[model samples]
Target: MIPEDHFGSDAVATNRMHSAGVALEELLVTAQKQDCLTVGIYESAKLLIADPDSVVLCVLAVDNEEDVALQIHFTLLQAFCCDNGITILRVFGVRRLQRLLRGEGANRNLEEHGDFHCMLVTNPQADHCRLQEVDTYCQESRRMDQWIPELSLQER
Candidate 1:
């Protein structure tokens, strides 16, 4: 696995490995607690435009091995989120996201179309602490003008 600092010191506020692990764990926990998490480009785009206030974070995956067009699409998504003041994080690929969403291990099989290029984490529930933590992380990241990591299709 790539070191957490490979992203940047701002990626995770804490230096502890467990804390970094907790960030991902907390994210999944928050996702499970709500119905606001949306997977897929179309659904995520709609959430970005129609309910910007509810969007907590936008996680983009480099899963499509097609061509640069897929990369362009993700760039556009990032621009949209940036313009809308939404926090965006680029992960390795769809498998990683699917694993998190499904609460499965690396050996688990991924369902077709279960792979999403963009996932919008929303806060429709409004009372969860984990979601609040996500929001806070995004807000702080924005304030520092730093992104967690920018994983490109070629990077995987």
Candidate 2:
């Protein structure tokens, strides 16, 4: 009982999601290479509090939606980002992102870096195209009434 327009809209949404994911992946990789990436919730929060202006983007990832503590942390982080005028994106698949950032078979130094729930891309010396792409996607999502658009990180 679905109308023809329903399928068309679904396809468009899928395309937009895919584009956002790719853009995010590219941004993360570039930030990592540039050494402008900050990992973990505590570390990112400290960085935000210490130097908010240096942060260009904040990405919150969640694999377990039932974690109340994590949810609260995200809420606080979102409010901070909003107040500071920093673009924030919600993504799923924290494990995938951890592997992507830390690399395969990397040592787990949770004590030093904390978990990979929140990541921040700090200011890079040079202009980045991926950053612009992500910003554009965020703006489009906001226009569509999505305050914090959710994206998925591809499994490699």
Each prediction's RMSD to truth: 6.7, 2.5
lDDT of 2: 0.84
Q: What's the distance in Å from true for residue 125, model 2?
A: 3.7
Taking the tens digit of each residue's C-alpha lDDT, what string does model 2 give over 43-86?
A: 89999999999998999999889999999999999999999999
Q: Distance (Å) between predicted and true CA of 44, model 1?
A: 0.5
What TM-score would each prediction reach against the true structure?
Answer: 0.63, 0.89
Q: Which structure among the candidates has the greatest TM-score?
A: 2
Model 2 misplaced regions, further than 4 Å = 104-114
Candidate 1 lDDT by residue in tens digits, 18-94: 34334644565466555556778877787787888888778777655566877777878888888877777665546
Cα miss at 76, model 1 (Å)?
Answer: 1.1
Model 1: CA > 4 A from native:
1-18, 63-66, 104-112, 128-156
Candidate 2 has its poorest 10 consecutive residues by lDDT at 104-113
